[model samples]
Target: MELLLKPIIEKPNETGSGHIKAAAPVRWALASLSLSMLMPSLSTSIANIALPTLAQAFGASFQQVQWIVLAYLLAITTLIVSVGKLGDIFGRRRLLLIGISLFTLASLFCGIAPTLSLLLAARGLQGLGAAMMMALTVAMVGGTVPKERTGSAMGLLGTMSAIGTTLGPSLGGILIAGFGWETIFLVNVPLGIANLLLAAHFLPADRPNAKTMQGRPDAIGTLLLALTLAAYALAMTMGRGSFGAVNIGLLLATAFGAALFLLAQAKVKSPLLRLSMFRDSTLTAGLAMSTLVSTVMMATLVVGPFYLSSALGFDAAEVGAIMSAGPLVAALMGVPAGRIVDRFGTHRMTITGLVGMIAGLFLLSAMQGRFGAAGYIGPIAIVTANYALFQAANNTMIMTDIQPEQRGVISGMLNLSRNLGLITGASVMGAVFTFASGVADITAAHAEAVAAGMQITFIIAALLIVATLGVALAGLAFARRASLLEEVS
Candidate 1:
């Protein structure tokens, strides 16, 4: 609270553009936050490349080894809401420092674990840390930076994620090839420690939130939420392995668990999830748009690579190379996109982004015309660049409306929406491809079927983008109308 009490930059001007002050402290702040965010984002994608290596090392099937990835995701989704509340009550700086420490320790364990189960457990710890960092980093920056520059700050964070994810596969391959699988986890230790130090030195300290500091966390609500998110995530992640009793049971459990969480939230004294946050229609709209952007981007990552590998008989290396285009361009476009959002407003920029993304998807869908990997690059890059434009704007929209004290929770909610979108995209895209291709197994499917399936997936994603555009436009109109009514009254 004291740290926030003395903000580095004051409230932005009327237009909400962040003032560019002396570049030293602000630059360090931005770079530290960006790199800190990058570590967790990289971890998300890097492990996917290591799955085969892990399976072989552990003498496990593909299905069994998936827990490594799912475990991390499960941990984040379940604990993020509570962690956000903790940051608000205790202090974000304290939470983030502790989070980085936990993450580093877990990474060490992951490097040395002798068994698959232990590694999976360590990964869960890593996710817990990642969730804390993810929840607080945006809020910390939002509070520290001039309000007008908030969009640019988010753009920088987004750039970190884009770079992390984009470079992860390549980085994993090099590390695994050069040193072994252990190096992948080991690398995080020094980096995490260095980041922890930088954050400690540069990141502002936290002040206790009067609103939540004294209240006890809602135990029942927390448990119910954990069960709800864990079950839902597990079901989505493992659905491809076939709908067995465990998976089916999890789904059923998810339904009940969600109902219970809702009930618990309603009854709880100090809730983990503040349902009242949705009262801000602008924030609600921003959340929706964020989810849609995440879904479309993730689905593109999924089906785009699959199309190259399955339909065109490309190797993993070639597919990776082709798929890299999107994030590469996205990284380049992030800052400019953020500035555009600050200037033209999130509404105009979102619509622009959506239209560009839709056009790119259309081009990608037509890849059935014997296009090579190079052909795919253009469309992917275009769409990816638009992603930068869209997400930066959407993030600014969400953060701008949130109260400073509530930023921690709302930031968590923002990340949660994006994470859910990713889960949905991966699961739904796979299912749709399976059904459209009429293949029980993806690897065994004929080229024609796979191609058709990829086309259909892209089409579906494009349609969602269109729907997202409509929602943004409508929400903005409704917000404007409400403002007019209030003013008239």
Candidate 2:
């Protein structure tokens, strides 16, 4: 820790433009930020792998233990924007330190909790901490790295997220086998400590923005938005596979809550989200594309395992190995994707990435079953790599010129769109797969049925990508028109 801290503690010398020029300090700063990004995703995936073990340990049912994951996800989703607004008001650095501290402590609490309820509570608290980190990390990039390299920074963070997600299952399995389930939560403690230290020492101190600091944050708007998101998330998630009366009730509540939230935002002294930000075609389109792309990507996770094991007759270990390829491809491609964005420019790269994804999805949807695992892996790899590129470019496009005062909230919205996508994809794509397979029970489905489901799911996923590509083109057209009008004026 000392060795790592010594070089940076002296204070990184900044260029005249105020960005960090020293590669070593810049690397360390990114390392701290990378860990911040890693912890939440790691915590999520690691806990997922341990759910069965936890259910047995606590003598609980699958539904009850599932809350352990849902609670964390809900907390992050509902509170992410609110926390981002708070960071914009308070100070990103200060709030980030508090968040890291809270996350680390929560991990410890989760590790030691004797009751399932206590663990779930701690997990929720951990999610709150994660909300602050996820919202602020990208927002801080402008302050940390040179503006030109923002895409690279975004890519590196994406890589860390992939690494954390990819590493979790395998690591959790080993930790559970060697030291039991508690160790999975406990393992975060030391890494969190390291992350906290590096972040506190290296990340840029927040410069107070007088514009954003003028008034107190909108408490009423915040509550309404949070409640609305929670309702929507529950509506999508609670039904498992079946959307019954409860799901319909929740959806109604979500719609009603959203109306109230929008009205409240317009009237509030300071709003959780400025309704006017949506006027920016780029931001609006970027958020839409993000949500759409994320929803499509979730199809891979929701459908991959069942297809591999049932259709291909792969064992659990083989299924796990095949599934790991997506994240592995993401990790490997992240930096290169970012570099490509830097060289080619964000708008062009964003389109190129989407195009690549469309091509990959077409292959997945139409490939001959006789080709087997190689066919699946090849197309999925193409999708994953393009996703990395799209994410970096799209993030770079939206984040590059955002007002400093609005950065935190904008970043939060970006993440919120992705989370909502994942949730929607899990529910929607799963339903589609089940409906297409012609089986009431997916587990008992025949191999040909499973293969048909996989192909049908990918076809829908490809269509979604095509729709996202249209969004990208529309955004570009909007930008050009706006520029022309500005010049005329």
- Each candidate's number of clashing pairs is 6, 0
Cα lDDT computed for each candidate against the true fold: 0.82, 0.90
lDDT of 2 at 287: 99
Q: Write the per-residue lDDT of candidate 2 for residues 1-489, one digit (tens) a residue.
A: 233223322333454344344666667788888899989999999999999999999999999999999999999999999998888988998899999999999999999999999999999999999999999998888888777778877887788899899999999999999999999999989989998888888888987678887878798988998899999899899968779999999999999999999999898777788899999999999999999999999999999999998888889998899899999999888777887887899999999999999999999877727577787888999999999999999999999999998999999999999999999999999999999999988889999999999999999999999999999999999999999999999
User: Over the stretch 292-326, how does candidate 1's per-residue lDDT look in tens digits?
Assistant: 87877778776776678888888987877877888
Provide the TM-score for each candidate, comma-separated. 0.93, 0.95
Off by over 4 Å in 2: 1-21
Candidate 1 worst ten-residue window by lDDT: 1-10
lDDT of 1: 0.82
Best model per TM-score? 2
- What is the C-alpha RMSD, rounded to one decimal, of candidate 2? 3.3
